[model samples]
Target: MRILGLDVGDKRIGIAISDPMGWTAQGIETLKRQSKEKDLARLVELIHTYEVDTIVCGLPRNMNGTYGPKAEETRRFGDKLQEHFQIPLIYWDERLTTVSAQKTLLQGDVSRAKRKEVVDKIAAVFILQNYLDARAKS
Candidate 1:
């Protein structure tokens, strides 16, 4: 079964997809948020296009491990997505995922402008990959 991963942000939503066998995660595309209706519609289209069975949403938490307003917003988004798509949704702790992505891009000598373009999507890939790896080991 294929799983979709989302890094939800205020202006953009990064997307990632797991392999059919659920072994690995790959960065897909970034969804530019226009409106809730449009964003959800686009997400539904992606779900259908990729034949996604499950969705993994990144939940931002404070360093002290508390859910903040952003996490609450993410939960609401996930709820809406589940209601619309009728797909299973899981929340993954996304602490420092963006930081990790940034560091990775820096190591690869990616320019700041380019990193801004792909950081969220790369973070989504990291989130999904971590989930896939954990599932494989279990």
Candidate 2:
């Protein structure tokens, strides 16, 4: 019951994976975007390694909960993943998740330079953990 979490952005994609029992999520790495084929190939390697059964993608929305162009782009990428992997994929509202990650890093006293390196991966962890928590609640 492993699940993969993604915080996809224009320049990079953060990656997280749940435990085999679907208990917790941990940031694995951040993939620097390249050509589409390269990016997908990299994702394929992670998916295979993790034996992911599902994908939880973060969908960035406006403050008022409106879907913006960014949201549509995310949906398209997620659709590509779902179709290619033949696995179920769901979107979790990602409003402020990156901000939350940044705050957490600040509180932890991580340097700004270091934070920039890992913020997206941490954001992926937050997104995945939130989804897991919601599933547990319901």
Candidate 3:
């Protein structure tokens, strides 16, 4: 079974998917958030399309390992997603995932504008890859 990953933000939601063997993750797309209903609808569609058995959502945490407002919102989102999707949802610590994505993009000399457009999806990939790697090692 495949797994899906999400990097939820205020204006956009980044999507990623694991290979059937759960070996790797690749960026799918970035969804522009419209409303809660629309977001959930799109997510359901993606879950069905990918035949996802599990969902891993990025949970932003402060450097000191504390939950902030954004983290709280992420938890709420996960709760809503679990209620609607009725699938196992896991939250992975996503501290600095975005920063890592940005650094990778900069090192690759990606255009600033293009980086902005794809950063969320790349971050999602990193988040998912981390989860997959951890699972593999365990």
Candidate 4:
């Protein structure tokens, strides 16, 4: 089954898609958020295009394993998405996915501007891959 992963933020939402077998995740695009209506519209288009059966969203929990404001915002957004699409939604703890993505880009010698452009999508990949890995192990 194809799965869509999202790293949601106030300004932009990172997008990723899993392979049909759910063995790998690929970065898609960084969606610039305009409004709730617009964002959901764009997501609906993606979900349809990719034939996504499940959604894995990154929850920005604190390092101490506590939910913070950002996590709450992500949950709210996920709730809206679920209400709109009626799709199964799963939240993956994403504490340092962005930092990990940034370091990976730096290691690859990507320029700052390029990193800025792709970091979100990369983070989404990390989130999705982690979830896939954990599920596989279990």
Candidate 5:
């Protein structure tokens, strides 16, 4: 199944999509947050465009594995996604994906400004790729 992954943030929402065979993930877009209605509408368009069957949303957990306000907000966003698409929504642990993305960009010598713009999308790719790898192993 083609799966869509999301890394939600206050200012932007990073998006990724798995290949049809679910073997690879590609960074899709970084959506700037506007209104909830607009955001959901844009997501719906992506769902239809990609023919996604499942949504993998990142659940930001504290390093101690406790859900805090950020996780709660992510859950709420997932709820909205489910209500709109009525698809399977999987909450995957997103512990250090952002940090990892940043490190990768730094290693590649990406400019700080460029990293700031695309970090979220790269993080989303990491989130989806990790999930796909785990699924393949299992």
Candidate 6:
């Protein structure tokens, strides 16, 4: 099944998608947040474009396994998404996906300016890939 992954943050939201077979993940784009309505509109368009059947949202739980304010915000966003789309939504632990993405880009010698633009998307890809890997093993 086609799945969409989201790395949501205060300023931007990272987007990723899985193949129809759910074997691999691809970075889609980083969306700069303006307003909830606009964001939801764009998400709807993407969902239609990709024929997504499931959504995996990054849940930024603390390293010690406690839900912080950011995690609460993510849950609120997920609630809105679920209410709007009525799709199966899952929250996957995403402690340091962004840091991992940044390191990957740095190792590739990507410029700092460019890395800022794409880091979120890359993090989304990592989050999705990790989820796919765990699912395969189970």
Candidate RMSDs in Å, in order, are 0.8, 0.8, 0.7, 0.6, 0.7, 0.6
Please write out the lDDT profile of model 5 over residues 1-138, one tens digit for every residue: 689999999999999999999999999999999999999999999999999999999999999999999999999999989998999999999999999999999999999999999899999999999999999999
| lDDT by residue (tens digit), candidate 2, 48-127 | 89888899999999999999999999999998998788989999999999999999999999999999889999999999
Say which prediction, candidate 2 or candidate 4, comes out ahead on lDDT: 4
lDDT for 11 (candidate 4): 92
What does candidate 4's lDDT look like per residue over 1-138, in tens digits?
699999998999999999999999999999988999999999999999999999999999878899988888999999999999999999999889999999999999999999988999999999999999999999
Per-residue accuracy of model 3 over 1-138 as CA lDDT, tens digit each: 899999999999989999999999999998989999999999999999999999999999999999999999999999999999889999999999999999999999999998888899999999999999999999
- Higher-TM-score candidate among 2 and 5? 5
- Relative to the true structure, how large is the alpha-carbon lDDT of every model? 0.92, 0.94, 0.95, 0.95, 0.95, 0.96
Residue-level error in angstroms, candidate 6, position 4: 0.2
TM-score of each: 0.97, 0.97, 0.97, 0.98, 0.98, 0.98
Residue clash pairs of candidate 6: none
Question: Among all windows of ten consecutive residues in candidate 1, which has the lowest summed lDDT?
Answer: 40-49
Model 3, which residues run further than 4 Å from truth?
Answer: none
Which lDDT value does model 1 have at 122?
Answer: 96
Could you tell me the C-alpha RMSD of candidate 1 in Å?
0.8
Q: How does candidate 2 score on lDDT?
A: 0.94
Which stretches of model 6 miss by more than 4 angstroms? none
Error of 6 at 20 (Å): 0.7
What value does the lDDT take at residue 52 in candidate 6?
Answer: 96
